[model samples]
Target chain A: MKRVEGLTHSYRFSWFALILAALGSGVLLLIVAPLAALVLSTSFGELSQAAADAQVIQSIRLTLSAALTATLISTVAGIPLSYVLARKEFFGKTALLAIIDLPIIIPHSAAGIALLTVIGRRSLLGSVTGGLMGSAAGIAVAMAFVSVPFLINAARAGFLAVPERLEKVGRSLGASPWRVFFTVSLPMAWRDIVSGMILMWARGISEFGAVIIIAYHPMTTPVMVFQRFNDYGLAYARSVAVLLIIICVAIFVVVRFLARPTQEAQDA
Target chain B: MLELRSLSKQLGLFTIADLNLRLNHGEYFVLLGPSGVGKTVLIEMVAGFITPDAGRILCEGQDITNSPPEARDFAVVYQDYALFPHLAVAANIAYGLRARGVQSKQAAARVRALAEKLNIAALLNRRVGGLSGGEQQRVALARALAPRPRLLLLDEPLAAVDIGLRARLRHELRCIHQQTGTTFLHVTHDPDDALYLADRVGVMLEGSIRQVATPQELFRAPSDAAVAEFLGMRNIMTVDSASEGVCQVGRVEIHAALADESTSYVWIKPEEILLSRQPFDSSARNQFRCVVAGWENSGPLLAVRISSGDLTLTALVTYESFSELGIDAGTELYCTFKSSAVHCF
Candidate 1:
């Protein structure tokens, strides 16, 4: 019976099946190889030149600053909203959650257009704010609008994972509502919120379509990458892309490693 | 002193209505009941976690019905210990003090003192999540007690601990209460917690306090049939009064004290009933010939179910007596208990 089973399984692995599997894997490798080649081929001097470009520098700085600012805003505002969503029950709560997550499913350019309609000079908020249509604030708002749902959802899951009993105990210990949030809930949900922030920040930094429509002049890193590829050739674009990738990868690796150790220790 | 006057709350399907309780200062009061009896809800109301919809919670003479938990000056220890996972033992203990605007040094000092008292000094720097069940419980207790709240509420604090650790924790809790003179309103379903730790016990059922009495009184004499059954009274038998001192169960007339002048339900603890293989003479006024309907082992005790005519009674006996009497289903035996043991309600 064992021999027959092995023979039948072996027979299923035809040459065509093997070839298909190899081809699939090879395609993925091929897609990733340009990124690898960019990293390998670019020297420090080329990276410096790319970094020295006035537009490139401005875009990189703008991207980091906007992404960081958006992340901070989300962290401050999103954590409480997430906690409320996780812990409270009220009418329209499910609908509210769905609305918060709507941007992730829609097209980025469409999201940008929708944002433009709401915050453009012709719109009510834009008129109230005296023309915030194509400024840095508009870009930040647009990036934040599209990326904030990830943070809120992740933070909500984190808050949900924390037992309600902990907060009750904190209250019973004479800690006020605010104290309990800081002392128990926030700390317990910190890792999830942090990871969520990282994702949101990354999302904000890479945003192209929405940001381009809203504030094309500000030129976030992804928009800059697109522009470089258009104005120059693949080599210059790849060099800048390579620099961005290296910086992001280094940051991602360090943070992930630090978080990984703590998670494992906590699990143990 | 803490008082809950007609305290009521509605949570979806469960409602605690018209619950009135009073806990004197420095008293250890245990609210005992079955699960879902709303004992925890009552305690939570007093602790200021849940507001009573139609009641007044008075601390000393002050009405604190609408007070937030921070303003209530009451601390609670939950069954799960609810220790802050991110805070160190010391930090958790200090949290209450810090929240109430205590100076950092004072909070630290208080934490140190509390840690020492709770015997968690060595664990002061360790995160609460790293501690064992007993250690976490101590930290929770320390945190709750450090603030010196007017009333201390413990909602089955030892319920989640292993059985082996329960007795020790209960003892430590009692000791802590004694040392602090803190008014403790403890909620528990376990009879042992009531018996061991409470100065007084309130037996609750269906969101109401059925009977509130001393632990001994609760065990020896419950206020009603429901209270008796709740306190593990098993030897209940219906009887017709023949005279002032005599009651008839089937064909047998047993002498029992006619304390209450009404048609009453009789309750006796299973352990109070004595089993004999043959007719034996004793001070117990009530004695009847019964057939052993069945027998089962309950931990170290043998639970013998006996039937006298149509009346059935349960008796808890030693394992040795069970074997020596050769007690089994269909064994004929005499069951007797003291007249004083019969509680009529």
Candidate 2:
């Protein structure tokens, strides 16, 4: 009886272990498949050529510049709004938070259409501004509009987690409100702010539906890939797509490496 | 000296109506209360974080009612020891000095001197996040005290500390208060804090100072029933004044000195009631034959709940007294307490 009980217990433990291993392996497979395929199919020479292609290079530069601009705008404008939403209490605060998060829940294509209706040439705002269409400025605005909520919400959560007592202490120490924000609140929430910015930049970079509706001529990398697939074929498109993927992966790796130590220290 | 005259504020459901207080220079004044009694709000008003609806705050006869926190020249220490996590211990200590535009050399010197005084010199370069709770508290005190504000407002500084460390930190805080001679307006919910630290204690209830007196006075003779109950008075009995120096309680004529003509209630400290196995006593005005209804053994003291006729009173006795008097449930004993120990209200 003891032997039988031991065998049954061992079987249960083995089954549990097996289930976990299988789920973990499946997740790993799903993640690695596309990257492995990209690497395997493209030769180094083909990658180098694709990297040097003028259209690919232009698209990459545009994507990076536009994403960076959006990130800067989001950081500057989103942080203060996030702080307000996080800390202070006023009338209509819940409604205001909902309004900030509206873009995230809406369909991206609808967001694009909404932007076009407001800022496109035929619209009243567009007519007043006189043609923001097909320009770098228009792309940045559209990307920022769709991507800023992520940054703001992330920053708000971060700022909310910081104890209000810390700021009170700062005030009691004779630091002005502005001084407290800059010295204490800002630094404590910096990790979250940076992570939010990164997420915003990533979202902005990948944005194709909104950018296509507002400004298709400038062609960010994602839009360029779509255009290439339509103009030529999947083979030509794959090379450029693979190149963009590599660039994104490298950037992500660098950012993660730089941010990891600070995160660990914060945890400690 | 600090004075708050007719301070009033209404925040949501809580309100403070015309609260007033005065603290002398170098005196440690403690505000004692239960939670949500506007103690924190009062401290905040004094610290200049929250402006009062109508009032004038004066420091040494200077009106600072409308002054900003930075210009108010007062420091506050919160219960949570709100040290900036991003700064090192030394930098945290030097923050107020730096804000005042003191030179770096002078700030460093001040930080070192204060850190040494607080016994936190060894933790100077360590980050605030790395320090223990007691260490963090000392660092916070060092930082707040380094600038030497005219008044220091402490909002329950020892509330967040561990139980064992609380006594040590209380001693340290008392020492700091003495060494610096800074006027401290401390807020707390613990009577022991008021007893050990404050030169005078103010009991606050519902946004009002019910009574302000020395710890001994507050404990021995609270102003009213609520204040007495708050100060841990366990035995409160209704008494009909029969004569000049006598009162009737449950068919027993207890001798009590009537200080007020309209006195209707009497309060006695639990520890003031003496328990004797034999019926022998001297001039302890009130004496009754009581049976021990129940007893609770609190560490180092036995709390005996005694019933005399229809009236019950709790008395605290030493473990030795409990054993020597053979006190237990249903044990008949004689209870006597001095008339002066009975506070009439």
TM-score of each: 0.84, 0.88
Inter-residue clash pairs, candidate 1 = none
Model 1 has a DockQ score of 0.46
| Candidate 2 error regions (>4 Å) | A1-11, A14-31, A261-268, B238-251, B255-304, B315-345
Two-chain DockQ for each candidate model: 0.46, 0.55
Whole-model lDDT per candidate: 0.84, 0.87
Model 1: per-residue lDDT, tens digit, A1-268? 9999998988886888999989999999998887777788888888889878887778788887888898898789888899999999999999999999999999999999999998999899988997566688888888898899999999999999899887887776667788888878887888888889888988888888889989878677787788878998777787778777777788878877776537433752
Cα lDDT of candidate 1 equals: 0.84
True contacts kept of each: 0.67, 0.63
Candidate 1 per-residue lDDT, tens place, B1-345, comes to 887899888976668889888888899999999998887778777777787889898988899998887788888888887777676778888888988889999999988988888888999988766678889888888888898988888888988988999999999999999999999989999999999999999999888888999999888677777787787777765655545666665676656676344535676778999999888778898888899999888888988899887678889999889889998889899998888787665
Minimum summed lDDT over a 10-residue window in model 1 chain B is located at: B258-267
Question: Model 2, B115-195: lDDT tens per residue?
Answer: 888889999998776788899899989989888898899999999988999999999999999999999999999999999
Q: What tens-digit string does per-residue lDDT give for candidate 2 at A7-88? A: 8987776777898999999999999998798778988888888888998899899998898899998799789999999999
- After the best TM-score superposition of candidate 2, give how far the Cα of residue B211 lies from its true spot, in angstroms: 1.6
